[model samples]
Target: MNKFNMTAIAVAVGLIFSAGMMAQTMSKDDYQAAEATIADKYKADKANCDSQSGKQQDICIAAAKSNKNVAKAELEARHEPSAKHDYDVVVAKAEADYAVASATCQNKSGNDQDVCMKEAKAVETRIKADAEAELKVLNANKTAGKEYTETGMKEKAEMTEARQEAATDKLEANYAVAKEKCDALKDDEKDSCQDAAKMKYGK
Candidate 1:
């Protein structure tokens, strides 16, 4: 799809990968294996930078180092899933991106370099802010859902109580009317009429 969608998908894949790993029982062996993988990849990536010289070499080395750091952070996060760990992953990615962008900016000179660095920082800040805002919104929606559910249950209970009270009042009013009619009867007949009213009204 679009660039933003692609970037989001990539990041989501990484997080999903971590979540899958976390779903399993993590062990010391897993941790050591992850560390070894990162180290090997980093070494290979750094070796690629040796072919270049000057600023190009510096940029390549920076990118390799950034990638290594981000990988390690992601591995650690997967090993221990927590809010702080997740946040660390986000922060790591942001810093890595900034490092790459900043290194690339060094390839420029004079006023152009200043503008490049400024733009890089601006983008980094915006990305980080957006991430924080998304986290806050997610938490807020969860809280609101809980509150709405509780309120709904309370209101349902109150409505049920009100209905029961109204039924009782209606039954009493009906029994009063029946008793008034029974007043027209005499002695034993009146007692029989009152008994019928009591049975009909469940008094």
Candidate 2:
């Protein structure tokens, strides 16, 4: 196979493995075994291609090497931290802002307290949304940086998808929290909380 086809095959295999094994953590021995298996397969593929003659042989060899490189890089990337620190920082800031906002609502009374809480929640939601967006961008940039050498367009597209997935995950988490908070309130307080959630998240 040519370099492009070989690369595609390797990517397909990697993706299949990635999809089949959804476990986030693997034992050291298992990880090492998996890596060795991949390396051996790559070597064998390269050796097979080496027997061919002329331009075909050269293309096959290049393809095998490219595939091996891509696989190795992908394995490394799975272990690499992708914007985890950045996301943590964003979450921390959002939590701090939310705390401050919640506290500000504590001293007021009746409608004033309700209004204050609503305003506070609005600000908190905005901060969280902004943070989530920033984190998504950071993650995309990280992925792009990692894959730029191999395939720029493919990496960019994957990173964009990853960001969207992350955003959806965050939104679901935030929505659950909002729902719980709304559930905790009673009567008009509940109404106020729902209103605040709607105003912040959308109707």
Using TM-score, give the best candidate's number. Answer: 1
Total clashing pairs for each candidate: 0, 0
Candidate 1: where is the Cα deviation over 4 Å?
1-25, 136-145, 148-203
Q: For model 1, what is the C-alpha lDDT against the true structure?
A: 0.66
lDDT of model 1, residue 19: 54
**RMSD of candidate 2 to the true fold?**
22.7
TM-score of each: 0.58, 0.34
State how far residue 161 of model 2 sits from its true place (Å): 7.8
lDDT for each residue of candidate 2 in 87-161, tens digit (9 for 90 to 100) = 433344344444544554555576566655654454445445544555555545665675556566666776567
Clashing pairs in 1: none
Top candidate (lDDT): 1
Candidate 2's clash total is: 0
Q: What do the candidate models score in CA lDDT, each in turn?
A: 0.66, 0.55
lDDT of 1 by residue, 2-96 (tens): 23632563356335433543444359898999999999999999999999999889889988998898898778777876545555667677777
